[model samples]
Target: MVYRHLNEKDRFYIEQRLSEGDSLRSIARALGFSPSTISREIKRHTPIDFKGLYCHRLTSRCAQEKRANAKQGQAFRQISEEAKMLIHQRLSTHTSDQATLFRTNKLQ
Candidate 1:
């Protein structure tokens, strides 16, 4: 399924459910998402101060920033640490010019 940003309605619902002491799992089931997803949505859209009080505006702004940052990178560029080390080692060995080009493309 394609991912989409949450609308104000969804945010409002999250706030409402949280305020009502609903568990993350319950909220997730209600919204047809995974529990971890619901938890992360709350954390992303509900930044808390040192005192741990949620600020809706700040949370929304954070969510906007996250979305903007995500758009800057290609999804498939994500690589594991071991894979990264292997790539670096291969580059050091200079086995293939095409490998270097592919690595450079990923860096960009």
Candidate 2:
């Protein structure tokens, strides 16, 4: 089976099923996911203060924020400021002989 991240629609469906007092296993079966997946989703998104209530809108917002923050953190970790400056400097200068050769050959 292919792995994929749950989207807003799936979260909303989960919310709807939960509201109808459906069991996690039943919801997971209908959604073609594992019961553990449904259980984890509920556990992760349901606020501690809200008791058992699960809001799809809030869950989606939280997921988006987490994804954005993770992406930003990964980008920073992959490239340092010094490396960025070096790349900028190289780009601002004339093309190197190797680059010119590659470009010329690609045109042929």
Candidate 3:
């Protein structure tokens, strides 16, 4: 099954509802998402100290870092402007192969 992700606004709303002492089920009903989703978000993103204050920027950055770190020990691929320019130059000169160009190079 495909999962639909919540937006930044929804995340902030969840934090707000959590801060306002609303039950997880109530917030889930209001947002039309499963209670498990709410529970997971809260558990994953909550501050270690459990302070009531919520910072959207911090939460978003933390989530991004978490995603990035999950792919550790993978092969590294360079994607700098210099590399792109070289590829473009090859394509312009008809020296690059289409199969190689379409290959998925995972970035570290």
Candidate 4:
């Protein structure tokens, strides 16, 4: 099966199923994911103040915030203009040793 990230709808289903006291394995089977995935989702997203309640909105928000924060660390906005220019120059010239170039130039 093709791998895919769980969306808000899937999170909602998980919340509903969890509220109904469904087993992790059952929820996983219904969602076409592994039981470990379900378990991990619950473990990771269950808020400390919620005391183990699997809230879809809270979980989704936390997941979104996490993704946003992670992206901040990897954003193009973080790249220096000199590095960007170097990359453009290398690409324009069909150079393949970008890593070596970056290392030599102390850009990495």
User: Number of the top candidate by TM-score?
Assistant: 4
Error of 2 at 92 (Å): 18
lDDT of each: 0.70, 0.80, 0.72, 0.85
Provide backbone clash counts, one per model.
Answer: 0, 0, 0, 0
Lowest-sum lDDT 10-residue window in model 2: 99-108
**TM-score-better candidate, 2 vs 4:** 4
Candidate 1 global lDDT: 0.70
So what's the TM-score on candidate 4? 0.67
lDDT, model 1, position 91: 78
Ten-residue segment with the worst summed lDDT in candidate 1? 47-56
Worst 10 residues of 4 by lDDT: 99-108
Candidate with maximal lDDT: 4
- By lDDT: ranked, best first: 4, 2, 3, 1
lDDT of 1 by residue, 37-86 (tens): 87777665654552544545666777888878887767537766656676
Candidate 3, residues 1-108, lDDT tens digits: the string is 567776678888887887788898998999889999878777777687867455556677778788889888543354655556656776787874763365323211
* lDDT tens readout by residue for model 4, 21-97: 89999999999999999888888888888988888999999888877787664656767787878888877878888
> CA shift at 23, candidate 1, in angstroms?
1.1
Q: Model 3 segments beyond 4 Å from truth?
A: 52-54, 74-108
